[model samples]
Target: MTTNRTVQTAADAALWLAVHRGWHVLPLNYGTKTPLRGCADCRAENTDHTPQTCPCLARGDGALCHGVWAATTDASVISRWAQRWHTSVWAVHLGASGLLAVDLDTRPGPPPRHPLNGLPWPADEPPPVDGLDTYATLAALSGGTVGDTFTTDTPSGGLHLVHEAEPGRWKGSHGKVRDGDDTVRTGLGWQIDIKAYGGYVVLPGSTSKAGLYRRSSTTTTPLWRPDWLADALARTGHDRTATPAKATSAPAPVATGGRSGPRRYAVGALRSACTELAVMEPNSGRNRKLFRSTTRLAGMVAAGWIDRTEVETALAAAAGHAGLPAGEIRYALTSGFNRPLPVPDIRSAA
Candidate 1:
C-alpha cells in the first residue's frame, strides 16, 4: 500500500518501501534501535497481562507491544504506528520476510592480534581492521568472493549485506568461535553478527543517533547466499542451536540389566531418524519429518532405552543441518516429548 502524501517522513517512506517488498515491520524508539515499549498497563511492573493476552494488542491499538513479534505488513497498522511514533525508526523482521543480514560492525580500539588465526593470510597483506576485511578473508578462504548484493551502510560505518533466504531456514548467531575449553577463538573475524530467524535489522534510510542508514547497492534485489559461504558458516559454527547439555559418556543402562533388546532398538531408531532428517530438503516436509522423528525418539526416551539429552542434541543437530529454524525445531521437539510414548515391538531386536 502507498504511504499517504501527508506522511512524508523518512521513517514513513522506509516503512512503505519495506511493506511494499513484503517485509514485516515494527517501529523502534526515535534515535535508537530499541523497540517501542508496550502500553502503560502492560508496562506496569506488577501487571499480569502478557503480550498475547494484552487488551491493547487484541484491539489492534498497540502495534509496538511485543517487539519483533508485533511486526506486521498491514498498511493500516503501519500507518497507525507511523502516526503515533512519527519519529520512530522502522525495522524489518528478517526471518519473517525470508531475508538474512550479515551485520558487519566497526568496533573501536586496536584490532586483535590473531583475528584470522587458522586461515591462510598473506604476509604481505595487512591484518583485518574491521568486519569488511574479516568477511573478505573468510570469503577467500571458502574459495568464493564477496560479489554484489543488496548492501546497506549503517550509521556507525558498518555494513549490512542483505541476502534472500528460504523462510524458516536459518537462525541468528553472533560471530563468536569457541574452542573445546569454551575459549573464544576468531569468528567471521570480529564484529560480525547474523540477523535471521528471531532477529531484525533496521530499515535503510532510517536515522539513528549516529546518522542515517543508507542503501549502498545499486539494486534493491538481494542475492542468494553462495553454497561455499554457507558451508564456511556451518564450519565456523553460525546458524546453530545451543544444546542444553553435552553427552560426555554413554547413558547408564536402565534397570532391566539382562534385556538389551529394547536398548538396541532405540539406538537403531535414533540413528535412522537423524539420517533421514539430515538429508531432507528444507521445505519438503522437513518440519513434519522432524516432529515424527522426535516423537519416535521421545518414545525411546520414555522407555529408558536412550538418554533424553542425547536424543535432543542429535536430533537438533540433524534438523539444523537440514536448515530448520531453531524455534521450529524446539517446538517440534517439545510437542513430540509431550505426546504419549509409542509401544516398541522389540521381538526382532538384538
Candidate 2:
C-alpha cells in the first residue's frame, strides 16, 4: 500500500507533468470533485445568480475561480497556487485542456454480504479487480494496446483511461449497456462516466475521500480519439458528433402543411437545425434570440420533424449558457409551439 506521503508526492509530480506537457490544470479539494472555493474576487462577482460577466476569464491570467474558467498552464501561477494550497488535488479541465478522461466506477453491490460489512459491496469479489470487465471492454473498443495509451487506477478501485482530444465540442456521457432483458451491463453501463465537454477528472496521486489514485507503470503518450470508440460512445448517447452543425446553417424552410401529409424530412433534419441554433451567438437579447430560435425549432417539432425532448435539451443548454433565467429559458423553449411557424414554401424555392 502506498503511504499518504508517497501519494502526496505522486500527486505533486503529476501536476508538474501535466503542466510541462501543455495541459492546463485546476485545483480541486483533496478528496472531492468540487473545485476549491473561488478566490474572494470570483466569489464576490458570482454572488448573484444573474448571468455574469466575470473578468477572470477575460483577463486571461487564470487567477482563481471554482470551475473550468480556472484552467491555466502558467508555471508561475501554478507555483503560487501550489504553495498556497499544497494539499489540493489536480483536475484537468477536459474540454479546455484537450484531454478526455474515461471515469469507470465499480459496480456497487446491492447489500453487505456479511453482517459486519457496513458498505453495500460484492462480498465475493476481490478488493482491486472490480471493474475489470468494463475496462477490458473499453480497451478492446478503444483500439490500443494495454500500454499504448495513458491510464490510471483510481484510489476508489475504479479506472481512468486518458486520450488526447482535439479542441472542439466533444460530448461525454454516463451510459450503460443493456441486454435483451434490459439488464444493464458493463461497457456503456451505469458504472462508467466519460468525462468530456464541461467535465474534469482527478489525476494520479490525487487523494479522494476513499484514498489516493496512482498511475500505472505503463503510462504512454495519449492518442487521438479512436473511431470505433467514438461510434460506440455516440450510439450509447455519450458522444457529440465530430462535425458540429454550424450556427450558420438555417433549418429547412417549413413547408405549408401539417400532420395532414407525410413529413418532408425526418427527425434528423430537425436535429441538425437545433444543433445549428445551439451554437448561434447568445446576443444581448438572449431571451428574445432563444425565443426566436425556439420558434424555428418548434416549427419543425409541430410538423413532427423532431422530438420535443431533443429540441428542448439542445436549446436549454444554449439558453443556460447565455445566462437566461431558468423560468425564462423554459418559457422560451416551450412557448414556440404555441405560435407555430408557417410552413416553408417548397414551390417558392423551386
Candidate 3:
C-alpha cells in the first residue's frame, strides 16, 4: 500500500498521509491551490465531453483533468499521481473525506460594527481585528471557548480548524453574510469561512508562495465539532434555506413518437428522482441512489424522450443538495450514462 511505502517526495508524503487518514485528495498545481488542468483532449473546445465522460479518465490515465472531482482515496491512484506530480501540492476534498474545515483568515481593516447580531463587542475595549479573534468571539457567544482540535496554521497566518462531520451535512460558504444582493452582516464573524460540502482545503505539509501550512495543535485526532459551535455555524455560517441555482437555459425537448407521452413520462420521472435525492442523508447510500437515478434518466436521454442538458442539470442539483460534491455527481452521472440502459418499463405511461 502507498501508505506503508517510504515517502519519496513531499507529494508522496502528503498522499500517504491522506491515505492513512482515509481522506480523498487530489493534486493541485505546485505551491498553489489551483487544480491541475485537464488533458489536451479535454481542454479542446471541439470535443464535447465532461470530466465524467473523458476518455483519458476512463482509461485510468491518472490525468489531472476534472479538478476536485478527480480526487480519490484509492492508494494506487494517489501513488501514480504522487510520482507524476512529485512537487504538486495536495488538497483534501472536505466533503468527500467526511470533514469540515473552519478557515480563519487574516484581514487588515477595522472590525465590523457588529460581528454577530446579538453578541456585540465591548465599547470600552479594543475590537476584533482578525479571524482568530472573531472566531473566539463567536465561540464565547455560543457558550464555550475555542476548544483544542486538529488545527493548522496557514501560510498567510490564518488557521484551519479541522472537524469530523458527515459529508453533505453542511454547505460551504464565504465568511461574509448576505441578504439577497446586500451584505447583512458577518456570519461567523469576519474572515471565518466554512469549508464543507463542495469545497477543498490545502493540507498541512504543503507549501505555497507564502509559506508552509504547519500543525498548530498537538491533537492528532480531530474532535467532533462542539454542539454549541455547530449550532452557531448552522445559524450564521451556512445558508441552508437558499434555493439551488437552476440552469439558465435547457435543451429543446426531443420529439417522442410525434406525441408528448414519452416526454411527459420522462419529465415526471426526472422530477420524482430529484425529489427523492434531495432529502437523502449521508449514510443512506446517497451516491448509489444518485447513480441509479442517473441511469434511469440516461435511458430517457438515450431514448430521446428528454433533453440531456435538462436531465444533467436537474440531477446535478439534486445530488448536490443531497450533500455529494460536484465531482462525485459527475463521476456517477458519467458511469450511469455510459452503461447500457436498463429495459424501460413504459407500462405506467401507456
Clashes of each: 0, 7, 0
lDDT of 2 by residue, 187-214 (tens): 2444567778778877776765667667
TM-score of each: 0.60, 0.55, 0.59
Off by over 4 Å in 1: 1-7, 40-62, 117-124, 176-187, 240-350
List per-prediction Cα lDDT, in the order shown: 0.68, 0.57, 0.69
Best candidate (score: TM-score): 1
lDDT of 2: 0.57
Mind sharing the TM-score for model 3? 0.59
Off by over 4 Å in 2: 1-11, 41-53, 110-130, 138-147, 176-187, 241-350
Model 1 C-alpha lDDT per residue in residues 155-237, reported as the tens digit of each score: 88999998888676666666543442221243455567878877888877677666777889897888888776675555444
What is the alpha-carbon lDDT of model 1 when measured against the actual structure? 0.68
Q: Write the per-residue lDDT of candidate 3 for residues 236-266, one digit (tens) a residue.
A: 4264543434334432333333257777788
Ranking by TM-score: 1, 3, 2
Compare candidates 1 and 2 on TM-score and give the better one: 1
Clashing pairs in 3: none
In model 2, how large is the Cα lDDT of residue 328?
52
Residue 139 Cα positional deviation in candidate 3, in Å, after optimal superposition: 0.6
